[model samples]
Target: MMNRLKAALAASAVMLAPVFAAPALAETELIFNSYLPPHDELYQIAIRDFAAAIEKESAGGIKVTIPDTSLAPSDRQYEMVRDGIADMAIVSTGGVPQLVTLNKIGDLPFNSPSARAASIALWETYNTYFLPFDEFKGVKVLSTNVLPGRQILSVGKLQAKTVADLKGAKLWSPPGALSEAVKKLGAVPVNSEFTDLQEYVTKGTVDAMVMAPNSAKGARVLEYVTGMTQIPGGLGSLSFAVFISQERWDALSPEEQQAIQRAADGLPARTGAAADEVLAKLAPEMAKVPTENLEGAQLDEFTTLLQARIDEWKERAAKKGLSDPDEVLTFYRDVLAREAKASGS
Candidate 1:
């Protein structure tokens, strides 16, 4: 009778085993390294929103943490993720040109008129053509985006009425194609990190800078600038890539991977929209600073000058072994055109 009771107790314990079983996996936490401050719209939309989406989609299986301090410099973000110093980061393609060459396609002059079109076109191009290049070998790319149209912001009495007015001006330029374009347009391009721009401007080292309106606003450029010169189709746009370390990416289960990707879907479009919002509000933000919108003959002349620079870019790209450089340019242009029309911009 005791043996019968013992057997019955063991059966009951087995029947209740499912209620106390442990989970199949532990929760995952990822570190997101960012150079931009939390208040920056791009940072909020791209990093903060992305983190929230990942957490929700993973259903508590994953959590992304963005520390209050930056883990690496803006230009070194790609290297930081590759070396495992950070799990994920947003890097400018132009910042690490040696590693991210194909992104130069978006850097071409007059590629797109607005950030919305440029961002969508850039993402589509990256997935369709640039993905196979091994440029981003150490990381898994989440999304790619472009800044709003580049404009000329001059400091303390420098005003640009035409492309010719840019000649002899000491213009601040970030590295890569934009710097080259600045030189081609006869300005003395001062290649420097964006962080040092304020100091440079305050010290009277640069007469002007080529940047997007939102970027200028974030940098508080109006404090040093007297006015802005806006160009049709913009001078050019910069490309940005969000990515995760390959090791961390590979460790994630297929379901986790899909979840993260789903959360990242349409991120480029969202970022573009955020940029448009910023652009729309710039007038009030810069109420004290004068602004000019180039038109008619001046606009046509600027377009011609940009075309020359575009030709140079194609030649340089061909030399770098990008087969059919013209084809790549044409593809990007067509994508931008389609996107702009679809968005009614």
Candidate 2:
């Protein structure tokens, strides 16, 4: 999972020789690293489309080029950008916990019903509360989006309607808080990137997974099991931030910087919408997989077990220098609810 290309470190600004076409194309060229697969719509809208928009907004004064392959692995993206191996890319907050603890507070279970709203809410919360702390000190954050909540999928059945059903079960969990949540609830956790989930499930290394419903299709794990229990928001979620090396952002002319910011506006919603679209497309098939609706006492019980997640999160947030972390969490939820209602999503 750590496999990364050794690309030459780039300078703060990679202004390339302008094309000799009838109209001069660019004075500034930014290398936007592509990490996820071609089918990933977030990359399409946030990276590729944003690049084109910035070029137009700047009247071709800025150009962004994507390499055929990524300069670094997904987990290595932020480090690469901060060290100047790439100009811009989306960094995963959950994947790099130490560098981005505060952002994960907004990812508590049952966060938002709509990806677009959750994403917009997450960014608003970040800009207001976390920015002054410089959580991501070396890179210039453009925008952020949290992925849709993951379903609690068991291998071949939906027996997870009760906490007892999960006891001693080997469940694949995203590392950090989610893993802690799984353990606190009595399930044995197998920690790894969801990209490798298929191998584990197929090899019988784990009996269940906490992941986005679309991963059943994307990771080719749809045929393996039939049980599904979606946790509101997500069982846990990953947050992504589009960022450019601070040096690169600082090097841009005032006009060029504004052009890029204009193009970056609403990126969180745009990426979140793309993610929702993919989830909606696969939802029907997911519905066919036997699911147990969580309600009544069962829901209450589950929530009780999840108190540890909240308690643990608050401690982490306070330790990170955030005052009144609980208020911050409430602020995120209020914003999410309002945005979701306004958008009718």
Task: Judge candidate 1 at residue 238 and give its lDDT.
Answer: 84
Each model's RMSD to truth, in Å? 4.6, 10.4
Which pairs clash in model 1?
A: none
Instruction: Count clashing residue pairs in model 2.
Output: 2
Model 2 lDDT tens row, 1-345? 223322322221233323333576589999999798878887788888888999989998998999889999888988888888889988778757768888886567777567787899899999999999898988889989988876678875438888898999888887776677788768998987667888998898887887777766788887787688766666667678888999999999999999999999889999889889998898778778888778788777888888778887889889989999889988998998898778776
- Kindly report the root-mean-square deviation of model 1 from the true structure over all alpha carbons: 4.6
Model 1 agreement with the true structure over 100-181: per-residue lDDT tens digits: 6677677777775777788888888788777777688889999988888787888867888887888989988776777777
Clash number for candidate 1: 0
Error of 2 at 29 (Å): 0.7
Model 2 Cα shift for residue 345 (angstroms): 4.9
- The lDDT, on a scale of 0 to 1, for candidate 2 is 0.82
